[model samples]
Each structure stands twice: as C-alpha cells, then as structure tokens.
Target: MKLKTPLLLLLVALTSCGNKPDLVQDNFSFASTQLKQAFVEMDAVRSAEPREKQALRDKQNLGPLASPRNVEADGTLHMVISRDWTSGFFPGELWYMYEYTKDDFWKQKAREQTALIEREKMNGGTHDMGFKVYCSFGNGYRLTGDAAYKDVLLQAAYTLTTRYKENVGAIRSWDHSRDKWDCPVIIDNMMNLELLFWAFKTSGDSLFYNVAVNHARTTMKNHYRKDYSSYHVVDYDTITGAVLHKHTHQGYAHESAWSRGQAWGLYGYTLCYRETGLPEFLEQAKQIENFIFSHPNLPKDLIPYWDFNAPGIPAEPRDASAATVTASALYELSMYDPANGKDYVMKANTILENLSKGYRTAPGKDRGFLLLHSTGSKMHNVEVDVPIVYADYYYLEALLRKQKLEKEGTAIL
Candidate 1:
C-alpha cells in the first residue's frame, strides 16, 4: 500500500475505534495474559532481598525520583538520580496502560504523574513535552473522549508553541548558553510534532501546521547524512536558512550514528507522511530504515546498542532502550508500506522476544522496571544500564502492537 494521506488519515481515525469488539477484545486477552505474568514478576522483584535492603535512599540518596529503587544488571540499585521531573512521558506511559487494560490503577497514576510533572513546570524547555504529555493524556482523550485530557494537552501545546522562534525557522531544543545556535533541530523532535498537528485540528489553527512543516523541512535538509543516517543535532542559521554546522550532541561523536535517534527519525517521518502524504517524508523514512536495518552492528535478536558505532559494546554495554523504541516504530511503519511489512514485523518481534527473555531480570530482581539495561545518558556516565521510564513505555507499546497484530490479523487499509 502506498498509504496516501487520505488512507493514512483514515487509519489514524480507525486506531481509536475502541468499541470494536473484535480488535480490542482479542488483544485484551493477549495483553491480560502477558500483563499477569509481568505483574507476578514485578511483585517477586519488589520483595527481593537486595532491593529491600539497598533501597534507592539507603544507598546514597541519589535523588528524589530515583528513590523508587530497582535492580540493575550488576544486581545493584543505582541511586544518583538527576532530573526530578520527567513530563509528558511519565504520564503518557500510564495512560497507555489504562487504554490497553482499562485499569483504574493506570488512570489514577496518570493523573498523579501529570500533576507532579506540571508542578515542576517542565514544559517549555524542550520539544519532548509533546511526546511526554500527548502520547499519554492526549491519547487518553482521543480514545476515551475525556475532556480533561484535552485541557492538559492544550496547555502543554501552548507551552510548546511559545518555544517557537520565528527568526530561527525551528523550535529550540534547549535554552543552554554554551550552545546558542539559532533554530537548532533534532530528529527526536519529529515525534513531538504530532501534538502540534493535533492542536491544529482541535483549534482550526494554521500556525501549528506551519511550525510542523518548517521543522520537518529543516530536518529533511540538514540532519540526514549521505547514507541516510542522521546527525544528533543540526544548527541552522535561522536568518539565511544556512546550515551552521552539524554535531552529534547525544551520540558517541559527530559522525557516530545513535540507533535510538535514527529510530526517532524513521518513526517521526513516517508519522509526518501519515499526516501530510509528503512523498519526501516517506522517502526519508525509507532511507533511514535502509541505513538502520543494513547496519552490521544489529544484534542477531534485532535489538540495537545505544550507538551503532560505539566501541566494544560488551565492555561498555549498549542500551536495550534503543531496541524497544525501534520495535515500536517499525510496528507503526509496517501499516504504511506492507511490501517490507514482514521484515519490520519480524524485527519488532525478535526484539520483544529477546527483551522478555534475556534483558529482563528474573522474578525477585527488579520490580518497578519491566526491562533492564537501558542507558539514559552515556556522556554523563549515568544510568549506564538501569531502567528508563521511556524504555518501559515503548516496550509495553511494542507488546501491544504484537498483541494487536496476532489478534486483528492486519487491518487492511
């Protein structure tokens, strides 16, 4: 399927057909089965000796957010937490749980987490707030018609809009002094633009779409390398629309390919194509996929390291979080172009299988986190192989995708 704009928009609408008994009912069965197993494992890990004894606070009082301790691969609970508030993402995961299982626990947690993130006022600093909030509460509203979620999403959208710099032709990633490059763009921000698109529909506003197109076009021009691999960051001279320089802020170095960031590009552009039917967006998505899947660094199980070109991964282990995100993105992409559907589906499946098998600690090991070996920020030597909230969210989403497929047998567009 070519997945033109009208067809993709139709699919997006159908995604919210929660009342469809055949789809939700069948997937709910699979979700319930896996969730039951996960729950038992979580409980056993919670009651384990190591976690009970060396709680996050007891170890070194790493930080407030890290207080909810969980075991790492080294069989120790890491404490030194940085960043107290992670917005949109934390609550977003909770909302996914609520949607998947209709569990009140997930809904309650979403409300609590949203309030906590809002209290910290973490909205305007970066583009991540859209993914963090909309993926959770925005989804909540879309699926359930909850007006409250709309209020939350709109507020977050306003915060995102205020960050827009007309002079730069892009939204600023950070407000740091060291790097004051105007209109700097990151591939990860593409995921955030979905919320902007949604805001346009809700408010009948053109500004949101204009911002999204500018961001998308800027990324298309600057971030992509010859092989389709992308730079982690690109600074643009907002005035002349000239490329200032390309740098890898989060990856190993300027030339290194970060697997997770590439995944973001693939998933983000696929989403852009879905909304706009831009042939360029679809082509870019395919280009990124070619680079990612063809890389020799891909593990046999299809999970990726934190960086594709990282040195001696066994010595300094890679992040399984990258794999989880890629899996979910591939699953989403499969619907658009079924020619490579099985390849992407199988890749996602392999990652999920490996994660549920090896990466996950056994029962009575790590209660709160579903997957281990997630690297948060390798540059800072922090959370080298600990649980990350985003990894957990994506892992659950991949599982949902698998369940959705096995049950629904591919809803033909």
Candidate 2:
C-alpha cells in the first residue's frame, strides 16, 4: 500500500514529533511472526490424545477449540470454543494479518480459524452473536466476499435480533445474571449493532436497521452519565420498558466507568455514525472521546486503569485492551470530524507508540498474544494484567486503521 502524498507528509510529521517511524508497518511485522507461533501452539493442543480431545471438544459443542483466549497463570495457552464470546477475536486478528500483508498464507489461516465458529450463527441463547460471529465471519466475508460467509452473517444477525426485547428497545446482554437483572442490557451490546446494520444492507431488511437504530438511541438515553461515561449494565422491567437498575458488573463500583466499556461505547457509536450518518451518534462518539482524553486519571501512556474510579490509582492494573479499542475508534472518528482529524490521528499515534513500546509482550513470549497488561475484569480478579485475545485483535485493527489513513486518506469503516 502506498501513502497518499498529503497524509504521507502528515504521518511523517506526526512520527517525527514522537512516534517511531513506520510504527504501523513494524507492528504488523511483529504480529505476523507472533501469530504464526500462536497457530503452531494452538495446533499442538488440538492434536492431544483422541479421547481427551473428544471430551474437551464435546464441551465446545463438538468442534475443535482453536482460538486463543489468553494464557493461563501457569504459562499454558488457553483456547476457547466458538460458544465463548472471545473465540472470534483471534480469527479476526488472522483476517487483519491477511488484510495487512495480503498474503495467501494468512488468508488460509483466517479461513480455517473462522470456520471453527460458523456454528455460532444459530446460537441465540447468548447475546454475543455479534462478538462470536461477526468478528469472525463478518471480516471473512468483507475480505473474501464469500457467499457462504454472507449467509452465516445473515443468520447471526437474525439470531442477535431474537434477543432484542420490543418493550426494552435494547438487546438483552446476559442470560445467566438473571438473579441480579431481570432484563439486562449492557454497553457492550452497542458493539454488536454493526452486524445488524450489515444484515440490513445485505438482506434489505429494514427490521435489522431499525432494531440497531432503536437500540443505539435507547442506550444513549439510559446508559450514559452526565459526563458521557457509561454504566456497565442497565436492567430493565421487561413488562413496562422501565429501567430497574443501573450498576456495574466489571467496574470498581456501580457508579464507576469501566475502561473497556468506555472504549466499546467509543467504537460502537463511531460505527453507528459511519453506518447511519447520524449526527447524534457522531456527537456521542466525540463526547466519549472528550471524557476519556480529558480524564485526569488516564495515564501518561494513554492506557487506562481497569476502572476510572478504582481506588488503587497508579497501583491499579492497566487495561491495554481499552487503549487499543480507543485508538482504533479514534482513527475512524478522525475521518468523520475533519476539524479534529489531525489531532485525533496524533493522539491515536501516541497510543500505538506507547503500547508498542511498553505494553506489548516480550518477543517470543505469551503464546503469540501481542499486547499485554489487559484486565478482563478486575472486580472479578479474572485475567488481571494478562495478555488477552481481544487486545491483540484491536491492536492490529488500530495499526490497520493507521495504515489506511496514511495510504488512502480514509480509515476503513
């Protein structure tokens, strides 16, 4: 890919200011090598003794578990089945590799990984249809234009719509947290709306578009604080469409802003704006950016503590995953706001630079996961300060967005 002249000059100036030159290219190179090892490790695990493997495979709904989720505390690679929300992220990373390198090898790898998750299209019991299906099949279709992938996407979108409660105007997020929330809707659900929008476009079904729009509007009304920070979960009265509770499942407290939740809002609304050209979504995304960047507690390195209100402050674990998601969102948000485009790119570049310099795994470490120090849920003490799959997925996505901006003067939608 060749950089357009003006963006090339702008990127050069931005890199000279602080970032390492060719940061995007260098990261992708690092990712390619790391991901190759990830594949080997995953393959080895899947080739375990037949009886033991079959029992494990049965737990994953009869499919081989190949997607890396995280490394366990004891230095073991943790792979998840398609039913896991995170299963799609590694495949998405593989797609990103193919997208950046245009290498047939990565394409084949992505296809193989993505195939493992195709069964998720019919999984309606969980609200993570988008996370499970779109991240894998959606990217696959986008790159390959495979008709089969399109069918999977359509089915997944339909399955996701099943979770949308007409009274609540939002998709139910978790079915298991029933004792706490009658009809729970989460900020994370915003990320899934993109799959619905794509389904509308592909199938010409206005229902998908309307459901996504209504969900975005509803979440905007109910989930946000005065400062634009969001609550992690909002429980609704299924009968009356009234909010029953607003609290956090993953943040420090009920009122705290979960860092990854904020990043999800940023990325979600930006894509909503891209898909709908709605000024409200664009304005919402900008407000979220302001809240994040202007917060005093955000680190100098641009990574965030697990929660903005976490009591530990500098002692808190940093979530590199949040930074990567925000970086990727800002690159696209920059395109939508020409007045602030350069500033957004500069900020995003700084984040990428910082993450690359400090937050990445040491070379040949961590079973090929790229970025490190991501907290899955500090409140639950899960995956604290560990390398998680989604962090690497968004890190590569950010790099790809930066590359597209420099080369074509536009970020991919």
Question: Whole-model lDDT for model 1 versus the true structure?
Answer: 0.69
Candidate 1 Cα outliers beyond 4 Å, as residue runs: 1-85, 119-122, 179-183, 409-413
- Tell me the deviation in Å of residue 397 in model 1: 1.0
Q: Per-residue lDDT for 1-413 in model 2, tens only?
A: 98899999998888786754578878988898899889778887777637777787787565767589998777888888788899999999989998888999999999999999998888888888888889889999999999999999999999999999999999988899677789999999999998999999999999999999999999999999999999999999999999999998899999999999999999999999999999999999999999999999999888999998899899999999999999999999999999998989999999999999998887677899898899998788888889999999999999999988888988883
What TM-score number comes out for model 2?
Answer: 0.93
Poorly placed runs, candidate 2 (over 4 Å): 1-21, 48-53, 56-62
Q: Give model 1's clash tally.
A: 5
> What lDDT would each prediction earn against the true structure?
0.69, 0.91
Q: What TM-score do all the candidates reach, one by one?
A: 0.78, 0.93
